[model samples]
Target chain A: MFHLLDIIGTIAFAMSGALTAMNKKLDLFGVFIIAFVTAVGGGTLRDVMIGRTPVGWMLDLEYVYVICFAFVLTLVFRKKFEKLRTSLFLFDTIGLGVFTLIGLEKGISVGLHPTICIALGTMTACFGGVIRDILCAEIPVIFRKEIYATICILGGIVFFLLKSFHLDNDILYLITSLVIISVRLMAVKFKWYLPTLEKN
Target chain B: MFHLLDIIGTIAFAMSGALTAMNKKLDLFGVFIIAFVTAVGGGTLRDVMIGRTPVGWMLDLEYVYVICFAFVLTLVFRKKFEKLRTSLFLFDTIGLGVFTLIGLEKGISVGLHPTICIALGTMTACFGGVIRDILCAEIPVIFRKEIYATICILGGIVFFLLKSFHLDNDILYLITSLVIISVRLMAVKFKWYLPTLEKN
Candidate 1:
């Protein structure tokens, strides 16, 4: 189930990246490159920082396969996907939750401090979008105004809080994912936003 | 001597990053972050890709100290450095050459292919600037025009060619650095540029 969710997250992020690149009028190679980075850049960063070499994607070609699939799917249905922004957003939120949990797990497995683990989770959930925005030549949207990383940090807090109770691993994962997804959904639905920092 | 060049390169890159951030009107924290990344971003990416654990800067606090020193120096002499563009460019080019050789050595140490090592060399020499440009919301200068990376690629080719002739390691390093530095200097003097790809 966890593996399945990871695949879903990768596909969603990849397609979102492809769509953004298309909007930027990037050529095919550029579009594909953007898509690939958006799906794996965050995890690659996390792995590198934690001393996990060969990175996750390099060890498993499934990521490459999925990103390629997402690229083709986005290109084929670009017009249709334009009107399906709501669905895309939903999938992206799912991605945010799953990726954060994955990062948290990796950090814990490495016996990292809770604070560092939270940071890793936040990076995993959000760095891909940060990278995508950077490549597209924009100030990262989250840095400007979004409740995005905040949600991941919150999820990490909840995951640790639940773990303290000695809850079943499955239940702990389920609750944390739900908390993240629901918080994100409500943040969007209610139009929650972080205030943009002023140029000083 | 190599270590000295690396420090010079780090200081130059950090100062350049600080100047760019200052131009963008970022606060002190943002300026420092930009400086830090500009100094170490290239090597960090290379180390991660090649599975170098803990990365170069993390293992050696000297990088952090130098970047901090550079940050303060840049802030204090911002106005004076504005007139030192020639010196800055010279140092940056030196950094490009030194960094490329360092990357090539690392790749070779890990027993990677010559082609992959060449790529690592170019990336280590250029990616810091790329990340800085991306953060500053501009298409990477190298990707858009400059013959910057091309010089590093040429240096890698020359290094391997000299290796085949059974040159001394020290002589090979000296010749390769000289080649990269001179070619970059001439490229700038000659106003050489890559043709920008057209939007299709």
Candidate 2:
């Protein structure tokens, strides 16, 4: 079940990355590279920091295959992507939720501090987009525009809070991910955003 | 010693990052973060990819101290930074050479392929600047403007070529770094740059 969610998230992220690269007028190679990075960059970073060798994607060729499939899908349906935006957004939110939980679980398994765990969670869920924006030569949208990472951090907190009660592992994971996904949905529906930082 | 060169490289990279951030009109905190990233970002990325846990700076606080020192020095001497440009450039070039060597050695220790080791070397010596540029909302200057990474790649090849001759470790490292440094110096002196790619 977790693996299924992960694959869904990777596909969403990869398509979004491809779309962004196309919007930027990048070459085909550049588009594919961006797609791959957005799909796995966060988990790769997390794995590296936690000393997980060969990285998650490198160890599993499944990710590469999925990303390639996503790339082709995006390119083929570029014109219809506008209509698919809502669906894409839904998948992206799912990705955000699942990736955050994965990061939190990895950090907990490594016995990292709770604060560090939360940070890892946020990074896993958001840094792919952060890297995507950066490669497209823009400040990361998360740092300025959205309530995205805040949801992951909150979800992480809730996970730990529930863990204190010795909740079932499966229940804990489900609840945390649901919390993140719902909050993200609400945030978007309500048009919630962070205040832009002004030059002082 | 390698350690001493690494420190010098860290200080130079940190100050350069600080200087760039200040030029972008970032607040003090922003400047410090950029400095920290510029000094250690490449090595952190390299370490993470190679599964080096805790990372170099996390294990030793010396990197943090030197970066702080560099931050202060850059801010205080901001007015005179123009005068120090040549010296700073020299230091940055030295960093490029030394960092490439460190990365190459680490790859060899890990028993990676020669090609992968060269890539690791280039990443160690160049990715900090790439990340800095990305954060600053510009395409990485190295990707377009300079012969910087090419030198590191060449240096890596040279290192391996000399290794095939059974050269002593000290002499091998010295020659390889010298090759990188001198080539970079000449590249700059000759104003050598890669041709820019146009949007197709």
Candidate 3:
């Protein structure tokens, strides 16, 4: 189940990156670079921060192949993607859920302090999008008082509780992912946002 | 002498960043951010890679003041900066020298392998501009060619040789910086470029 989420998340993230490249009028190679970064960048950072050598993508060549496939799909069927935005968002939210749970679980497994683990999980789940935006020359929505990071943090805390209760792995994963998705979706629908410093 | 060069180099890099931000019509905060990153991003990366905790700018608040002063000068004296393309290039070259030498020396100080030190120096000297370009939505010239990284590598090797011969730090640093600057200026003058790879 987690493996399926990984693949789904990779594709969704790649699409978002590809869309960003297209918006920026980048060439094929540029688009591919962005796509690859979006797909693996978060996990790669997490592994490096936690001192997990050999990195996730380096360990699994399948991630590379899948992202390549995503690139081809984006290149060959660019127009079709315009129609897929809504579904793509759904897929992306699912991927976010999966990424959040994976990050939380990895943090716990590494025996980090719970507070640090939650923060790490939030970073792992959301920073790739921030990086993508920074590279694409757009302000990262996450940094602008969005509830996006908040959702990831909440999901991480929920994961900690489920683990304390000794819930089954699959059950814990699903619950955590669902929470992230619901929070994010509701945040968007209801225009929930964190308060920001007043701009003069 | 090296201290003077360091200040001049940082000023040149910051000016370039400020000019780029101006060209992009960025806000004051954006310009400041670009200038700060251009001035000190290289050193920060060097510290991070070497596990030098509390990266350079974070440690010395002076770096912050320097960057802000540069930004303010650029903003206040916009007309003077507008006519300084060549002057800016000269400063950037000087910066290339100081940054490359300082980066290489710092790498070796941290006990990285000789080859790694050279690579780190190259990255430190050039990656700031690379990041600056990426943020401004341009293709980074460093990634596009060998000259940027290659020049740093050559200078780093020269530094190691000079040290092995027990050369004075000042003389060794001058020689390395001069070599890097000369190579970069010549590359720009001669329009040096490597062969491009076709799509895979």
TM-score of every model?
0.62, 0.61, 0.58
- Across A1-200, the per-residue lDDT of candidate 1 in tens digits comes to 98898899999999988887777766565576678889999998899889887677755767888998998888778878758889898889889999999999999999999999999999998999898888889778888787999999999999999999999999999999999999999998999998867799
Which regions in candidate 3 have their CA more than 4 angstroms from the true location?
A: A1-44, A47-110, A113-200
Candidate 3, residues A79-184, lDDT tens digits: the string is 7766777889888888888887778778888998988888877777788888777666778878986788888889988888888999898888888888899988
Candidate with top lDDT is 1
Candidate 2 residues A30-148, lDDT tens each? 99999999999898878878787778889889999999999999989999998999999999998999999999888888777776687678878888887898888877666555788
Off by over 4 Å in 2: B1-43, B49-51, B56-130, B139-200
Least accurate 10 contiguous residues by lDDT in model 3 chain A: A52-61
Rank by TM-score, highest first.
1, 2, 3
Q: In terms of docking quality, how is candidate 1 classified? A: incorrect
What does TM-score give for chain A of every model?
0.97, 0.97, 0.93
C-alpha lDDT values of all predictions: 0.88, 0.87, 0.78
TM-score of 1: 0.62
**Native contact share for candidate 2:** 0.32
In model 1, the clashing pairs are none
Regions more than 4 Å wrong, model 1? A195-200, B1-44, B51-129, B135-137, B141-200
